[model samples]
Target: MTAPILEIRNLSKAFGPIQALNNVSLIIPRASLTIIAGPDGSGKSTLLKCLLGLVRADAGQIYLKGQLTDKNFEQIRSISAYMSERFSLYPDLTVEENLDFYACIQMVPKDRKDDLKHRLLERTGLESFRFRLAANLSGGLKQKLALATALLSSPEILFLDEPTPGIDPTSRLEFFRLLEELKKEGRTIILTTPYLDEAEKGDEIVFFHRGKIIKQGSLSDLKNQFPLLVFSFEPETNIFEAYTELSKLVGPENLILRGRQLKIFVPEGEELIWRGKLLRLKREEPRLEDIYFYFERRSEMMELGHDQ
Candidate 1:
């Protein structure tokens, strides 16, 4: 693994009775993209905010570039950029104008400002849309502008919180392509996303659930660790009806319905039963969603046991 750019240890945060983060610790590798994946209300957003000092962690320390800076994040923030879940740039400002505004805010050197702006605009494919108001741009273009603005500082690490939600697939693809280029240029990216499909593209994934990281690893590593076999088949009957029937045989938590296709988790010793019930079932590789669902349920079960 590459040398770590950021190290977080025993981080915790709370909002009154709700614990937003619970004893979380993670090492973010240098020059690679590490995805924070989880559902809403999970600690993904809170974790990012804590790292950037937007929200203070109640406990634990954050080390940036191997130097502890829990009390002051200025040094870390200086070398990093963040794009919030919401579009933070001025919607009324033209794309180019927003870039200029952020550039000035980041204090880009006068000699490098114009050149950097021009290059980012071209790189993000926003050169032609430079004169368009941010509000007038499509969902995709707005995101592009936001990204270009974030890059104005030429950050070493970029933190994005759900950058692709509500974005069209085509635009999402373009946005990720730009990220890949950034990674190739040796920039570390830490992104929080609810979409597991998007998380699949990262070098490492940190899976969170209800204020804690339940799993963290590379895609293949996680897949190899998955203990259950996934059997998928298109239901001959109505999907929901089939799902209901299967729910009785195998818990609903073990089933995933995708359109007309039904996927079931076949336990180590139950392959024969599943295969007998679904004549056309085929064993398939588990997708990232499958892995997440499995871990989330397992975590919930363990929590229930502890409570009991």
Candidate 2:
């Protein structure tokens, strides 16, 4: 593995008596798209703030690109671009005007500004609407504009918080296309999102919960860790009622209903494994969502002293 682009060591922070980050430590492999996956209030946003030096840590050290010094703090700050969840765009400003305004703030050179702005607009599918006011843009377009502004300075690292929480399906796909382009250019990215379905899009995932990292690995590894024998069924009866009836036998934790299909978690020692066959199951595959819940349950069980 190449030297870490962002190295966090013993990083801890608190808000009065509430510990936001608990001795959190991790490394962002250079050029890798690392995602800090967790539910809301999981400290993902707080962790990002600490990395940007926007929030001071009570204890710990951060190193950017193998160098660590207070003198280089300002330099390190300039090398990365950070985008928050609620992207701020001037409602009255045209798409092009917003980009130009951000470029000026980032100190983008006059000679290079036109080309950069045009290219970003074209790549983000905003070229046709370049003259449209931001307020008139859709939720997706606003996000793309935010990303475009972040890239205006061409920073090496991009830290984004839940870039696609409430976005439409089409917009989410488009944002990922832009992410793929950035990934190909060897850019380091760290983003936080609650959507487990998006896990496959990242090179590595940091599964976080309650300010703690419960799991860290690639999507495949996480899926493999899911302890369940999945089962799908399409019955002639009420599907929800079937789920409720089966819940008594296999347990509610074992059943996950997705539209017309269901994924049942067969405990290692439970008798539900054979019941799945007797009950007539279909499409059998462990998806990322299943794996996500599996880990979440495991963490909860661990917390509840189910395992020591």
Best by TM-score: 1
- Minimum summed lDDT over a 10-residue window in model 2 is located at 267-276
User: What would the per-residue lDDT of candidate 2 be over residues 1-308, giving only the tens digit for each residue?
Assistant: 45688888878888887778888888888788888888888889999988887888888888887666342367666888888888778999999999999999989999999999999998888999999999999999999999998999998999988899778999999898888889889888998998887767888988887677777888887767666677676656788887887778776667777798667777554444333456656546787767676677667767777656
Candidate 1 lDDT, 13-108, residue by residue in tens: 999999999999999889999999999999899998998899988999998878899579898899999999986879889998999999999999
TM-score of each: 0.90, 0.82
The lDDT for every candidate, in the order shown, is 0.89, 0.82
Backbone atom clashes (below 3 Å) for every candidate = 0, 0
Q: What is the lDDT of residue 299 in candidate 1?
A: 86
For candidate 1, list the clashing residue pairs, or say none. Answer: none
